[model samples]
Target: MLTYYMPPKTMWSNLSKETLRIYLDQAQQAYNDLLIGNKPISVSYSQETGAKSVTYTQANLQQLQGYILELQRTLGINRRRAMRIRFR
Candidate 1:
């Protein structure tokens, strides 16, 4: 028999269930930027102030991905979505 030790609730008490999903979505968009067939995530446009701006969502891609992975592990969130696909 195998037994898994569950972490105390306090360890993950502050982690939101939606945190990983939100980050995953943002990160996926960023990840696709490098794919040949997929559309890029970055865009250039002007703000209301008429200033040119570049919108590159991937700027925090690394940080988002890291937090997502960490929250997934800490919250055991991946175990429940083994074959689930969610779109928003």
Candidate 2:
């Protein structure tokens, strides 16, 4: 049983690159699991200046994929390949 906790968006900026990468990897794994018909538990947390709140959501492919993309963007990871042309 795999459980994934989504850190608050505010926390993302405070996270180190390695931490973001870990989250990205976990999100991708959860996305793949959902594709294979497995529903993992997804927990989310929200924090205010003086209050903290927690919410639970059913794992969905799209959400996980979106999170992964967000993490990649934060990490400056570009997946697209550049095409090169050679002039003789």
Each model's C-alpha lDDT?
Answer: 0.50, 0.60
lDDT of 2 by residue, 1-88 (tens): 9854444354467667776777677666666666776665453423334433322235355666677787776676764546999999
What is the C-alpha lDDT profile of model 1 across 2-87, one tens digit per residue? 86756446433454657535544654555566343443354332324463433344355565466446656665655542477899
- lDDT of candidate 2 at residue 49, scale 0 to 100: 43
Compared with the true structure, the alpha-carbon lDDT of candidate 1 equals 0.50
- Root-mean-square deviation of Cα positions for candidate 2 versus the true structure, in angstroms: 10.3
